[model samples]
Target: MKILDRYILKSFITTFATVFIILFFIFILQGVWLFIAELAGKDLGVWLVIKFLLFYSPKMIPLVLPLSILLASIMTFGSFAENYEFAAMKSSGISLGRAMRGLTIFIISLSIVAFIFANNVIPKAEYKFVNLRKNIIQRQPAMAIAAGQFNAIGDDFNIKVNKKDGEKGEQLTGVTIHKRKKGEEYATIIKAERGLLTSSESSNLLQLELFDGYYYEELKTKNVRDEKKMPFAKSTFSKQIMNIDLSMLNKNNMDEEQISQTNSMLNISELNYTLDSLQNSYTKETQSIHDNIVKRTTNTLSREISTSERDLSNLEKERDTLKKDKNNLLSLLTTSKKQRILDIATNNTTSNITIIKNSKAAQNERMKNINNHWLAFFEKFVIAYACILMFFIGAPLGAIIRKGGIGLPIVFAVIIFIIFHFINTFGKKLAQENGIPPFLGSWMSSFVLTPLAILLTYRATNDIGMINMDSIIHQITKPFQKLFKLKSNEE
Candidate 1:
């Protein structure tokens, strides 16, 4: 262990740790803001909030770790180069590779740690985080129903509101509720132009007060005549109140993770198994759907051909009658029969359209889920590779730029990271929509930046500037210079 190597490692580590802590905290604050809806009025204690943040912090590591390494590498090496430390090393016969050997080893070891953390630690954290949120929402039903898309209160009620106002978010607008009743003709639906959610005097109940709304219930009738009439009941209301039972909801077992199979909650091996099963399921369902659609579309084609033996005696007479009338096929049918045929065709077309529309939505959702799992599988490897990639680029770039201490070095690191992040996001989104393979999308940033890393390493090692300004200037002025010389010659 040479003193120089030790010094270099110490410097890099110091910068990396400082940058990591700052960035990690910043990102945590951003997380808090992003999930304020779940946190603000929930009465979750300080310790619970801290626990929630702690559970969420692990997921930020993949983003924070690489960027910290990049910025730290740039600052440390850039300071060394700016201070003529590289020149001193070069004078002492210590090459650039030798100077880098210590940091490279450290980075490789750190990348391995990153891989383990991403594979093992992050998934467990995600599972816990999801479950904790679920438990919190369960205990506080108002949090779930405050403002968002459809949120369930046990198995009975689904509540949604267009907007929420007031200090505790108890005030609501555009409220809609659906009550689930098994074996009923249809679930009772309650909609209100305005609504309020309030804690009931009884601890086991929550009061939902609705205004200017309608209650709709479709009646299930045993009588065939009444069923044929399709009876339903509707009532208009100025103000209505409902007491929702909360005793069953207060079971706060945070450790009981009901959702164990989310894509983010699985390790690489689990993801592989899940992905295979999903793909197989997708294939089987797709094939079944294809067969069903084919059977539906070819309903008329697959039928028995109605070849009837026409009376030979009447055939010539019928042909003569058709020739005399100059009639189309429609003219032969009665108007009532024609209308019935048209109605049947229209009904069949409408049914097929409905089936396709419904199938498309479900199939697309299934495909999106599969893509997300594949992305999760690939991302575990990506974070590890990204660490090495960022270091390689940043180290050499710093040495070349020879500027440090949060000036040009920060600019370079930010620009490069932005490009990387943007490309990575684009690829994942594309993959999610099935526009590209998840493998390609996940590693797209690495593939695009690998050559740049190589180029920077080559330039810095060989003592070349970022650009040969002399050559660029010569090329840019060559045509103008030639034109000026020609004019001078003509003069």
Candidate 2:
């Protein structure tokens, strides 16, 4: 490497390291504050909290890198400007572009690092962080039994302990277990002289060993005729062990549905597969809708034809039967002069025919509505690529911002990212419920941001210039008064 290149690279590395350390400490402090908040009402060890923060650090790198770069750049340039190093370089026949060549190389390298973090490290860390939270929440039951407080482990299990000894690895005095199960309550109150917890891997059990304690177990059995109760008492001979299946206490183990999600721990390939599956789902949904439409249409027409035939048959039967009845009535009428009976028979035939026509019209209208819904379902499949589009938009935006610091940049990024995120989310909902074009709704953020990024980058690069803020502000404000005719109109 050239001497200038080496020099510039060294400055950038030092500045970046300084900025990273500063930002990292800030982030760690924030994490600590959050950890403290989480620990406020709980019995958790400080080391365990620190361990969680350490595990979570890698996930912050992606957010931190960009912000670090921005701050580092500002500091690096500001230092050079302050020392007149830039001026000296310019006077020594080195152009600004030439001096910046090494910085550009450094920026490109950082960009690659950022990309790697975003693509690989961040995803894994995120997965781990989520799992860690689940693990902590699940394991907290074991940790919750502190000195001098009543702690509830699960839905119906309560425990209290008085002094805990570090050397003996046991708790002393005041142990209570209140267990309730399925409309039955059982309380085991113990004033143990000493207590200790022991676990066995083979049996997957956590045993609470209490020494010198009076024990009581209340059992109630439901009966159709009468209820029964049993009481037990124990004075410590040597030891009393209460066996609990620790695996059952492990909430993480029971939540299999949570583990089944692709979003939880998926790699890029898995994400791609999920996206493909969603696409395939939409495809199948569309095909099913089309198939349903065709089947429904054919069934409706067939049913209509059958109904008409049945109606005609009924009408003919009615007419034939009525004619017979009328003939009978006529014979009766001739015999007895009964004109009212003949008039009532004619009215009944007309009413039956009118009912059949109305039923057929209603069936036709329902079939039309079904066909329209099927057509709408087919249209939604085209917009499924919006997820991929939004990702591209977000990734490029991180680069364009140039300020890699997580403070404001991260806030901005998240705000922008979430806005895009929610837009896509709401768009999907709209598409599902209101028959909106899923594609337009889903890709709206990407479409809006792509042009905005391009325009900003163009202005930042060629014309307006990102660093030349004063000049750009002056230019804008100078034209604003003239365009608005404020000063000229006053004159």
Candidate 3:
């Protein structure tokens, strides 16, 4: 029994290591492809690209680990069963249950380690990956600008270039620039036939030198009352220079603590803390909204709470008097007065509807944030449990199929993983949008797959064939067989 356990354990470990390495490589390449647009053509250096891949690798563990476990389990068990080893063990009075005990214990332990890795290591990796990418892009300010598109330079100006050339990508052609200021429009515009971009490594300053350009400035008086026709000045220059401040891009100013406030950068305990805060904030916001609506209604209606019943009775008496004099009042009123009354009612209705819509919109946004926090809280555990669940599915499936090696195992593993992925993604979207309770939405895939795993295990243990193609085909043709027999008897 000890020998058998060792054999199974050894097989699973070797297979798991190989599968994990291959899958990791494949996923990293896929990730690189997805982010190629940002990482490529930037001359970010080989080490930076390597660092990006290293930092990004942890994000793929939750996805890759479970699939590796599933495939390794299938391959291991299938190889044993295919070689008649399971039959020999059964002949010696060892049951399938006993055979699985060693592997099951190993899988349970692995799941715990995987869970801890997800909770601890992944958050830090996510933070580093995000900030490093930002820092890299920020360091190369010129790479951030795109040709043939308006790009803002530190909120001070907008510049566009038709073409970017030269080995250093410093040459710009057919340039257009507009100067911006706070609380004002673009007061100045500049167009150039060509421009050069330069920056100093020691100082956070970007310089743009334009040649053969025209500058246009619009002049306006500060006092609105004394404003005359707006004057404009236009000047053409052979060369001009502009300086842009890049102090904000300084790496010293980067605040990792502030960035880690997002859910992606928090572990389990932090997620729970965030969730609690969000729920508390949501409760306060709802209360505030209710109080605000009540206050607004009270102010707009202009009615005293103490005089409510008296006002109602008095208002009824006035309404009766008004009803009695309705015809007389209509005859005495001017057309403009009637029209003005109608306009006031229409405007009030429209205003009330608009207020309700805005209030609802704000409430929905608050609820969405709360739901997102809850989803993040539940997702950590769901990913951990999915590991154990996948193993159960793969082990039983391998026993039923009785095939070995990578070919059949990979096919089944990929198919099962795709199904799991689809369910998880769909459930996550539903949870984020508040379509379902966060707990239910987050655990939906596990809840669905667990029962399938159980059913497969039961069938495998009971020696029942899940897919008997011959039986299915026979059942379908039975109706046709009966019809032919009836026709032959009649003939």
Name the top lDDT candidate. 1
Q: What's the TM-score of each model vs. the native?
A: 0.72, 0.52, 0.79
The TM-score of candidate 2 is: 0.52
RMSD of each: 10.0, 13.3, 7.9
Runs in model 1 lying further than 4 Å from the true structure? 142-242, 247-252, 297-299, 302-304, 307-358, 467-491
Pairs that collide in candidate 1 are none
| Regions more than 4 Å wrong, model 3 | 146-152, 156-194, 214-235, 251-260, 303-349, 468-491
lDDT string for model 2 (1-491, tens) is 78877886787678778868978989877777876645554555677666578667875664455555545554454455446665687678775456556766556555555555545665566566666656654554455565567766555566777666654334546666655555665565555677786654344466788776765565445663333333444444357787665575554541222434334244445555665665566557556655765565466444433323235665665666667577542332232223443443455446545644664465444433332333223222212222223223332333233333334344654565566556656665665443565445545555666665555435433324344434655787987867779767877
Which one wins on TM-score? 3
Error of 3 at 187 (Å): 8.5
Question: In candidate 3, what are the lDDT values of residues 128-207, reduced to their tens digit?
Answer: 88887776656667776677778766767788889888877789999999887878854799999999999866778899
